[model samples]
Target: MAEHTIHFGILGCASIARRNSRAIKLAPNCSISALGSRSLERAKKFAKENEYPAYVKLYGSYEEVLDDPNVDVVYVPLPTSLHVKWAVLAAQKKKHVLLEKPVALNLKDLDVILEACEANGVQYMDGTMWMHHPRTPKMREFLSDSHQFGKLKAIHSVFSYNAGEDFLKNDIRVQPDLDALGALGDSGWYCIRAILWATDYEMPKTVTALREPEFNEAGVILSCGASLSWEDGKLATFYCSFLTNLSMDISALGTKGNLRVHDFVVPYQDHVGRFYVTSDLGWAGIPEGADPPPTVHSIETDLPHEAHMVAEFSKLVENIKSNGGAPETKWASISRKTQIVVDAVIASIAKGFEPIEIN
Candidate 1:
């Protein structure tokens, strides 16, 4: 750890793994040392197509990646169904884990994976890029300001994309066995995380799924919405779908202010991210002279949000390896809280759209 960069071994040739591989290349403290897939040809093709260095090892089985003595971290971008098994195995092998979301099938499964990471003293983090975005903290800073933005009142989030007929039919995301949570797990995971983040990770008191969720054949969700409320009257609603055009929106209202972000999941441009904020509304009516426009805050970054996420996670791993430090529990807790809300929403829908109390 003193003078060596952390080595990453990706356990799957999934589409998302390509992005993580690129991020590792961008991270100063990390390098992609190996690639693994069920088919050795697929792994070799991925490595060649991605222009990995000649030194990068290719493995036919994921377990080989876990067994590699030089692999310091295992990036598991496999489907939700495969997450628990490979992620747990990687942790048990004493390798840090960077897992893709919808971390597991449910909280019980998620807890088991988390316990494995804890027992092995390895860091656990979901590949949620926005949490590492520079603009996210700027929005939070405004939300936390009492004089500018008072108590949070409500939040509305939407994330969706038109996946078309072919993807709907063949994509693993919409397949019941591959990802039973479907749209709720794919798009809705970010919505739930955004809401929980804006609330400072406070668990909602109750979660109610909106009526009339759309589903594909084989009983997988295609689109769904949910409402969450707190004891103090704070409320949040989120919509996620595979049927709509690409859109990611967040509208947050406070007693004295409002915040809006059109692209919260992935920014329109990787280098620059922007959000709108309006504060201290003296009166609902027109202002004294020409009404002032809402403040537009722009944050510039050298790397994309996903790359930042990789860098942040790599730094944590380095700390543990170099300083003999314990794994940070904050990232794991955030992933768990997001999964908890996701579970409640799914439960509500299954139980006739009835309100499910968040336990």
Candidate 2:
């Protein structure tokens, strides 16, 4: 363990927070300093349930966590609506923020959070665990190799899982006031991020919601998809749903090659990741075994991706605290681009599935 460990304070007891709590503990340079909720008893119960150390503080309100001098970072797993409020305040308090995904309900609110973090010199990172995985960079190396991958042409991504009836009816994700973007905000965030990442965060020329998006009685999205195109002839499409079997994938095709990954969001198993790539395509099979085969590449890591995210965040915080370094803005910038596309998707759907121009 590092001598200068950073303390993490959680501001909510959301189920996702439970997963992150474990991750924070798994990180060598991070430790849970506090857990806060609307109910002190709830915090106590959660601390016990999660087997947190007895020395960890418990608070009845989120403000207490922000006010704690021992806390160096705040992990906010609150709903989308509350993100703007808590995330901005955490930044203003000069605590780095690790926020849950679907960064905000809209780009405007997201900008507010980003501005706060920038103004306060606090790092801001959305909870996209896969971004910290070693395998992601390995895949990126291939995508960036023009000689092998050539000019990128198209990309397809899908992230979906069957939310049980209870979840569909009662989950905050399905509620407009809590998580207005719903399925698009929840799952589609990953799809959009994947596409933007593959394109080096280039803004799409246009975004068109494909077909129709299903909505619940409250007008929250349940399933949605969108297509994005660029002037360079690069195109991408993604689908996200709360009404499908478990599936997470990304397939990108270039003029000279292509790559595919079945579990891009979360690996099928912890600590191990895999992707396939094939480069060569003048024509189809010319004879028996004539076509090239995809090379299977797999990476095994010491810790799960979530824990890796925590360790990476901690390293950045350590640099800022110990070496007088500025916070890394790349994470927040990527998140903003992802949210821009997300807002475009919402607009396209609102206009009756018309194409929404991206500026």
In model 1, the Cα lDDT at residue 192 comes to 94
User: What lDDT does each candidate get?
Assistant: 0.91, 0.92
| lDDT per residue (tens digit) for residues 86-127 in model 1 | 989999999999999889989999999999999999999999
C-alpha displacement of 198 in model 1, angstroms? 0.3
- Report how far residue 177 has shifted in candidate 1, in Å: 0.9
Give TM-scores for every candidate, taking all chains together and pairing residue i with residue i: 0.97, 0.96
lDDT of 2 by residue, 21-49 (tens): 88888888889999999999999999999
Off by over 4 Å in 1: 1-4, 282-292
